[model samples]
Every structure is written in structure tokens, then in C-alpha cells.
Target: LVDHKQTALPALIEQLDSEERDHPIRKLAFTLRAIGDQRAVPVLIRAFPKTLLPASSDYGIKIEDPELKRWIAKHDLGKGRSIFSYLRAFREVVGALQQLTGQNFGEMELFGVNLANTESQRHLQREQFHQIAQHWAHWWEANQESHGVDPAYAKARVLMAGKKQGQLLDKDMRETAAE
Candidate 1:
């Protein structure tokens, strides 16, 4: 897709904020990450909240522990409320941002439902998520001018392409034919 960035980039950026239930936000972010363009940062940030753990539940993960599953099945604390965080599409956006910017803004931890059973614990979790999101947003505001293709992301792309296809594709996906 990077080779077709002239068209692919804009289309992906345009839909990065899509709220359609079946839109592959995760795949879009992944392609943008592979493209390694700093231009996608803002759109990626915009899409971040849609992937967050909803306010209805303190826990951000699906219950996978057999014991926890049994307990949740018995309790009415709000089953199915914590599944979003477990999906980790948010992490893909974060990972893309990290790759594109070569920065770490931190991510929220997934916790068991019991940990957030109390109102205070839930509130704390919510605050932490907000703070992390804020950090990324603020960082972008302050550092967008410095944004560009991260060297590491670029280098890895080159090496991977070379090893896989014996064709060296640069960060822009140009220079492939010459190589």
C-alpha cells in the first residue's frame, strides 16, 4: 500500500475517524503504520477514543479467567461492558503512533473486573486513560513540526522487504524498481 500512498494515504486518513461498526480501523491503522508517514498522526489520534474502554465499566478487558468468568456470570455488575479494551485495537493505533513518531506515550493496563468493582477504582482507571490520551494529544500539538518518517520504522521496512522479496523498498516505497 505504501507504493500507492498517493491514493492510499489520503483514503486511509479520510476514514481513520470512521465510526462504522464494521470499518477496519485496526487494518487502516496498520497500513498507515506500514506507510510510516507522520501525516497520519492526527487522524490516528482522532480515532483513539473510539477504541477506549467505555465509561460504563472500569475494567477494559474481556473476562478470560475461568474463576472470574464464573463470578461475573453470577454478578450483575455489567457483563460484556469491558470487552473493548481487550480487543487492543487501541494498541494498534498506539503502536502505529509509536512507530511513526518514535515516541512512547504509554497505554492503559487491562485489569480484572474485580479490581474495578469499586467506584473509586473505576474512577481511577478512567482518569488514567484520560491522562494517557491527553499526553499523546499534547505531545502531538507540541511536536508535530518535528514529525517525519522515523528512521527505525523506515529501516525495518527496507530490511523486511529486501529479505522477503529481494527488492529494497524505501520508506516512500519508491526506489524499488531501481533496486
Candidate 2:
């Protein structure tokens, strides 16, 4: 799979922008992490905003309680369904980014906060996730080019050695070895 990841990377990235709800974009993002390529960083950043909104209705439902709806509308709490979906997807996207970069950048703690536990928690966590997402976006913009990539030949050799050894090398070590 490591040997095949280079060929799959392009398609996985392209899936980030696909409008098809049936597309497993989250899975694709995680696959990019499994590929362990630094090139996936920018693509994952781009996918972050897109992931904040769930594609399926199963994630949550619209606010049906009139009192709750009015309170939310007045207080600027997001639409109930969107908030739930956004938090769920936000956590997932952040998880993928962490996996790809080996850099937490504070997202690990932010993502750990359970936004769906209660209304008050959701409101606070929503703001936190928003800020964290923006921070990640800006960080990517400033640092993407410096993220670095392993040359194809070198990556292939490492993959071959790992396969022969019947064990996968740690991703961070692989990148360090490449450097």
C-alpha cells in the first residue's frame, strides 16, 4: 500500500472537493494520513472547512423545539444539526491532520473537548473549533512549502525495506531518514 500511495494521492486529494455526498471524503483524508506523505498537508487543510459540514442527515437533525430554536437564533448558537455535524467532522479532520503532520499544534486538546455533551459545552466548543481551524489554515499557508517531501526513489526504497522486514517504519522516522 505504501508503494501504491503515490498513484492514489492525486485522486484522494481530488475527492476533497467532490460534491457527491456518497464520496467517502473523510475516509480519503484518513487514507492520506496512512500514506504518510507531507504533500497531503495542504490538501488536508483545504479539506478541513469542507469537512465541517456533514454530508449525511444521519449525523444530526434540525432544531425542532421552538424554544430551543429561538434561544439558539437569539444567542447566535448555530443551527442545532449543523453544530453537531460540524463538531464531529471537525474532530475527524483534526485527527487526520495530526496523523499526517506529527504536529499537534494544540489541536489535540481542542479536539478532545467533547462539544456534543451539552448545550453550553457545544457553544463553547464551537467557538474553540472555529478558532483552531482558522489557526491551522493560517499555519498551513505559512508553512506548507517548508513541509518537505521525500523523493520518490527514496520513498520507494524505504517502503521496500519495511516490507522485506515485515514491519512498517514509523512515519516520522521515515521522513527524518529521508531528510
Candidate 3:
């Protein structure tokens, strides 16, 4: 389904947007990466912010005790984990962008930082995320029109053909060895 980027790409983007679940969104982002379409860049960028938020189910839990709620919020128990996941997801998106555009804007390093270890680290990581996202957005806006299409799409076809030829050669070799 991912290879058929003409249709599958847009559908996946819609799913990424509409689905509140992090798992589905992460799957869609990886699918888009596998598709290797330059068109997926913008969609991935838009979905980046969504990854930072805790799942809808997290909010649905009814906390009866105000003190507990305050403690949870203050310590960022669930929220910290969600942010960690978001950073990982954001890294994948940035990776896809780098692969598609052949540009490294240092986003991978920014996203890879271990922010969950300490509160100060988390603050720094959040600031870095904002900076990286802004940089990518600005870069995309400037160069979106210049990128014609996915270069990997053409390369993938070539690689597949090579693989088929290699398989045939291997089979012939096996037959010769048997004879």
C-alpha cells in the first residue's frame, strides 16, 4: 500500500491527521518514509506537533483526587513519557526528510537527546525541538518547489530489477552445481 504513493500517500496523511492514537500515527509516518515520496514531507511536519501530546485515553482517566492530579501534572508522569515518544517519532520524521532531500539540518541530534532523565534536560530538549521544527519548516518553504520528485522511487525500481537478476543467477548456479 505504501508503494502506491499516488493514492496511499494522501490516505495515510489523512489517517495521521485524524487518528489521535500515537501508534497509528507512528505507523503512518513510517509508512510514508518507506514510500520515499517527497510529498510526504509536509504531512509529516504537520503531524510532528500531534506526537507531543498524550493520547486521548490518557485524558479520559477520571482523577478524583485533586492532590494526585496536581502531583502527576507537576512531575509530568505520563506527559514525560509521551514527550519521549514524540521525540523518537520526530526523529523518524526528520530522518525521512533527510533521506528525501539529502539535507542534514542537525535535527536528528536534537531529537536524540535524552530529555527524560532530568527536568532541566527536558526543558532544553523542548526548546531544541521548537528550533529544529522551525528550521525545517522554513527550509521546506524555501525549497519545496525545487524538489521535483522522489529520487528513490526510480532507484527502487532499478534495485528490484538487480535483485531479480541476482536471484536468477543464484538459481542457475545451484542447478549447475547439482548437475
Candidate 1 vs candidate 3: the lDDT winner is 1
**lDDT leader:** 1
Q: For residues 2-121, write the lDDT of model 2, one tens digit per residue.
A: 459768877776675452232366456545655677776665654553443322332433567877566434422133333323224445566667766666767666433442656675
Residues 1-179, candidate 1: write the lDDT tens digits.
76798678867876765442323665677677767778787767655544544323323446778776664344322335544232245655677777777887546353222225577776665445445555565566567766654432222212221134344224323332223
lDDT (CA) for every model shown? 0.54, 0.50, 0.53
Could you give the C-alpha RMSD of every candidate to the true structure, in order shown? 16.6, 16.8, 18.5
- Which candidate achieves the best TM-score against the true structure? 3
Our model 3 lands, by Cα RMSD against the true structure, at 18.5
Backbone clash pairs in model 1 (N, Cα, C under 3 Å; residues 3+ apart or in different chains), count: 0
Worst 10 residues of 1 by lDDT: 153-162
